[model samples]
Target chain A: MNARAEFHDPATRAHLLADKARWVREQTLAIHRRAPETRVASSLSAVELLTVLYYSGIARITPDEPLHAERDRIIISKGHGSICMYPILADCGYFPMAALETVCKPGSFLGGIPDPIIPGYETINGSLGHGLGVGSGTALALRTKGKAQRTFVLLGDGELNEGAVWEALMFAAHHQLKNLIAMVDCNGRQMLGYTDSVVNLNPLDAKFAAFGWQTHTVEDGHDVAQLLAGFEALLASDSPKPKVLIANTLKGKGVASLENAPLAHVMGVGRAEIDAILGDGAAP
Target chain B: MKTTMRDTFLATVLEEMQASPDVVLLSADFGAPAIDAIRAEFSDRFVNVGIAEQNLINLATGFALEGFRVIGYAIAPFITMRCFEQIRVSLAILSQLRPMNVTLVGVGAGFSYDVSGPTHHCIEDLAVMSALPNLSVYSLSDHTQAPLFAKHCLAKPGIKYLRFDAKPHEPVCDAGNDGLIERGFRVLNAGRDLAIVSTGYMSHVAWSLLPELRAEGIDPLLIDLVAYNCVDTAALEAELAHVPRTLLLQEAVLDRSIENTLRRMAGGKLEAMGVGDRYIFEIGSRDQIHDAAGIGRAQVLDRILQHHAALA
Candidate 1:
């Protein structure tokens, strides 16, 4: 496509995206070490999702000009869980990589929750269930303006509990906002316990399909290849309805302690555990 | 045959939309006769987001983020209370970092939805909305001045809340609107004995009490407060400096209404009247409800007479 599409071959791009996903994972954990307040496990769950969107060049971005008119709009709806985006955005040149060190620190834009104050962030986030409605509105505006650019919203599986998300879902489909894309990081865990125990969100794909959305289920969200293929298929579709990728992922995708742990959402990984995980290849 | 504040305001909004396609109007399934024209003329720009106020606000924020001046229309209580967090986070908090132009036009301010019960009465809006920084709150007194405020909303950037009354009344603040948009308030009548400050429908209530106050040898000044937060506070302070006592009248609950603002400005030289710590369940007219709440025309007149006696 454009000069930014570094790898044209799908297989080669998938391999490159896999390497970038790991790098993003290490960087996210490293930042979590410095800023212990970050939701590290939640961040870990979204590594491949964010990595595929940014690295695979499926999203049209102008990193230097964060608010570039012609660029695609990406709303990180689940703000607290997206600390993985810090390193990816930095590496993409939206901001200096050094800024990642000051996350959760005073005067730093990168706080426990990602706000639009940081470059590449599209809206005020962290208050769950708001991004999809806002993204739908943005998508409606673009479609009304007769623009072909798309709007993407990244939401957590637990966030589906908010009734406002369903409102946006209906609005987008009724408006036939084909340019809107929603990716739910189905980590299956919330603050206290598993999402199913709190409130069931299974059959999420069928639910979306019933609401008149084009749905795709990415079986292994941690696999960069699978994530890339899912995104490519959704992006290539000419469906008039809004599209959603139900990316089924573990709450803590990697690390033995957090993986499958019901309370992984609020759990933090200490520096020693991080060092053991990254071990000798931590540098970005 | 009187026109409503919402109709006048939306008529002006329709004109603004006709002038610039960058202006967008969204309703939460709320409709008006004027809105019919908007939907007919510019169906592409108007959206009825069903009966969801939370989504209405979120959508308005999205439109504003995309550089469009947005107007979100809905019932006053549901628009502000039902989706308060959405307004706070998206418009209030987000506008601090981004240049947003969104006007939330909430119909049925105070007891305008008279017989619709307490659920429709929007009494806490002024207090709650003013608590948020960077939000411009406008409580319209009549339909005549609504177009001016509507134009101001389209011209300005940032968040504005236009609290329109559901009922229609004769024009009150109609001295040709000179400097009305800039001053954010207008001095309807002048006197030196006492200054009576009121907003929205309460301004009409206070204005109607002027004759009885003068009949009792009391010279009272009446001011209609339009823009609650960004009013020329210094100028209003200067106007109050001439009067020995200021009386704050409103149709909101006393706990968090503009009464607090005027009390602070008057430096303890003010007596505030409003609905005090209770919801009216009585089925009656607005005046009857006002009387039950102890803020009716007769009660306000009695207070003015007492203030005049104290001045004597």
Candidate 2:
């Protein structure tokens, strides 16, 4: 059965994506309530982006065979900011949903930073600025082997500070890796402060454009429809250049306290606050 | 005829690339004459990532993760030190979880680039590369060992670092003796008095000093330890069992020297000789730089004679 067929209705797909985003946010907060070590704000910033990718049927993945040769590879480079992935992956049957409770606990494979030990994860992450180059390599490999599978990497806006990312940026463009897609969760805030105040990457899209990438920007990253539209257009484009989607997003999108906090990256939501937000949601 | 280890090793890599469709060579803008042929012949598979060492390693890790055997090449100090965290995180740490075949070939061991100044001197690589848990450090002594080590890389499914000397030297290993290469060491000469254990370029130095030591009435054994971590310790222990005293020498710093490992394995019956625990700033020939670093030929002979005297 074609999984993408169900989401062809714009209204129904929008409703389903928005609903999944809400569930993911609630699950993220609930997971943080159990494992405070998880980066809640960073994870929250990327919830919509991840939801669009996993639920929109754009990423070709099989829970039964996570590392299947034909599957499109997704590298969550900003690993610490991807705690939201654990719940979504569990919901997709990548692992037992019951294992979500043991996240960051003793002997659990799920740590604060995700490794390739998880079935769905493609690379060792948490160390920023590694995913793009790795994804480029995979894209190159797939292209070399005459495979049509694409390689996607989710990066943080702050991760662009790493010079290695630029090296890969130059490489992918020069090599004309059209099969590679980079989605940057342009959440303004970094750990200590806003990326603008820390090191201004004000014209993010232009920077990628200047690097010779086919660039796209979604003014409202939280809007699932906008994200899905931007992603699908970029994915479908036949341009020989590598593509990047700059989704300008808000850090700590839903929670008010964290949304305004300068140090939201390190701030953890209290159990009571989480209970208040997700009043009647059952624990996974 | 003498040939640079990089040329011989890369020549073998060129063969591997021809034989296997899964092999890919990534370079960090560091090249040799042999690489020119690879670039011309296998342009599709040969990638020059410019002078970016970190990306060189990360890209190689990406290829290896996708079941491609990767050979990443670069200058010694920059490859091991400039992108250390990348190697640690991507290759060394990631390989523990995934099956990877990535061999990083670092040229210019020790003072091979003597005239290029201190930055090119890769004296600390032995200590740093060997410190990583899962990575094997292959220190090639001569051009003869390069092809074998290159083949060893294709057969192994783990992370490895090949410390190839920039200069060329005559074949040191006897012809048709790959068995010794697999054992990770070769007893160049058997002498009951003293065994001078070394690796890479220092093995050449030890080979040169052998007859002089013998003339001084102190018969010495030369063991070129090629593979740093994948050694047959039982065989090595048996070889060192009868030797009364051993001198561990390397053309590198004494702090965390490869000699330190040999000293431990020899049951404290060994002394280590290497460059002083400081960088050499004096501009001179390789031997003169060695003189400044206190590992010169005369200094090494004197140390060997003193050690032999103490043993007597």
Candidate 3:
């Protein structure tokens, strides 16, 4: 009904984010149970991060006025993995809550990969290595337009392997895009297996720091308290360098069968386990 | 008359950026001498995206969405092939949902980068760019057309690909009062029996054959198709109805080339005068490559004479 900014008392914010994260986790799973086409594991990884952005009102988006020029821009590069946004965007009033039931269905704006047609989404996602560059462009435009809006982008750590991401990182740092904040959901597992075993991006922070970005890391990305702290730091940042937070998260955060599994990226939850998780025989 | 398409294109871009604050020019570290002026004059808007075409398209999409007209310039081969998906997803599809005014300025059309080897020859740009949905393809023929299209593109929206030659070409005819310049296609010379149609550098070769054809008592019509895929097909069809025979010349492969377009519009094979499906692995001049691909002037002239004699 109103602006839901996260600049609240520390204790209250922690408790509120903790409760909201749990609710988002359930809603995300429920949506996946219905759609079945959504990437549940990757979506689960970014639940808290996206939950904090919308529920805490850190993103400066008015659902009714989603295209407000003064609002901060959030470009989610990992579209297929960010299905958590379906429930979050609906809850934020970008669309109706009923739309979540029709995700990946005929005539649903909510597809397997979130598109800009869905309100609250900026640039097109799903394709990797695009968010940072586009966000940097948005940030540059904001400065040129003399508007005070900031640009925030969410990318996957595995996406770091893309050469274009590095190209954008170099450009962002060279331009000193202080108003741009890019956070990587550092869920170790990519589609195939663990990123370390795949391409090995261990010194991510050092890489960003070396590229001249102000870098930070949360030991527990799923912790609402630490996640909020990282967002707060970037929001309050006055540094010339663009800031990046490598939020260390698990691939499949909540589900017992999925979490930390080698093949969690493509693992779909069966109907019985869905009923067990929600404690209801009713279809999502 | 003596400048490359890159110079004229960059010069026009500089002018566009000067007149409007919303026009942003970006490059993937590919630059010309004229680009230096643009970079110096509009340093804030002129960004070198570093040798990365994928990033170039992504940034252009974002900039266009934010109410800025963007131009992403790079070598034709690299930008079109390296970032094909980026262009398809970000620019081509996004433009359908929103008003996107992003123009991709790809230099080195055809074998303009002749010495750069197969890696640099952009013979495939025309085929691939035209295949994308909701895209306007302009295979420009001369330096004059680049600035002309540059002026026109500043006011246009959606995704446009200006396939420019790396080399400069003198005007076969004065382009100032040319109605065909804006009409997408122009009949340079009129004849009853046959017509020669071409785009980019091949147009120059087509223009050169006028005297040769006249000597043979054949003053065939010459049609310069500047806007390839976006050309007015109905109008071209009407023009073709008047001519008994047509020869479509290009530097790209025959598949998805202008001849295929003509076949769809005019309802007959007009003798595809272009390269066929195969790589020119052998290094040579532009003419040598054209000869190897069987689209050389001599080859084209032989085919045209044969068609004219058959029609007679």
lDDT comparing candidate 1 with the true structure? 0.88
Docking class for model 3 is acceptable
Q: Which ten residues in a row have the lowest lDDT in candidate 1 chain A?
A: A1-10
Please tell me how candidate 1 rates in CAPRI terms.
Answer: acceptable
TM-score of model number 1: 0.90
- DockQ of candidates 1 onward, in order? 0.26, 0.23, 0.24
DockQ of 2: 0.23
For model 3, residues A1-284, the per-residue Cα lDDT tens digits are 45355435555877887777788888888888887777999999998888887777677786889898878999998876998988788877889999888887755677788777889988777778788988888888888788888899999988888888887898889888898999999999888999999999989899899999998898899998888888888778778999998899998888888996899999988777878887886764
Go through the candidates in order and give the C-alpha RMSD of each one to the true structure.
Answer: 10.2, 10.2, 9.7
In candidate 3, clashing pairs total 0
What lDDT, from 0 to 1, does candidate 2 have?
0.86
Q: Which scores higher on lDDT, 1 or 2?
A: 1
Kindly report, for each predicted structure in the order presented, the TM-score of its chain A compared with the true chain A: 0.96, 0.96, 0.96
Better of 1 and 3 by lDDT: 1
Residue B101 miss distance in model 3 (angstroms): 0.7
Q: How would you encode candidate 1's per-residue C-alpha lDDT over B1-312 as one tens digit per residue?
A: 478998888899988999998999999999999999999999999999999999999999988998899999999999999999999889988898889999998999999999999999999998898777778999888998899888899899989999999988888745556666888888888898999999999898888887899999998888888987789888788888999898888788765447767887898779788765333434345787799878999999999999889879
Stretches > 4 Å off in candidate 1: A1-5, A280-284, B256-312
The DockQ assigned to candidate 3 is 0.24
Q: State how far residue A137 of model 3 sits from its true place (Å).
A: 1.1
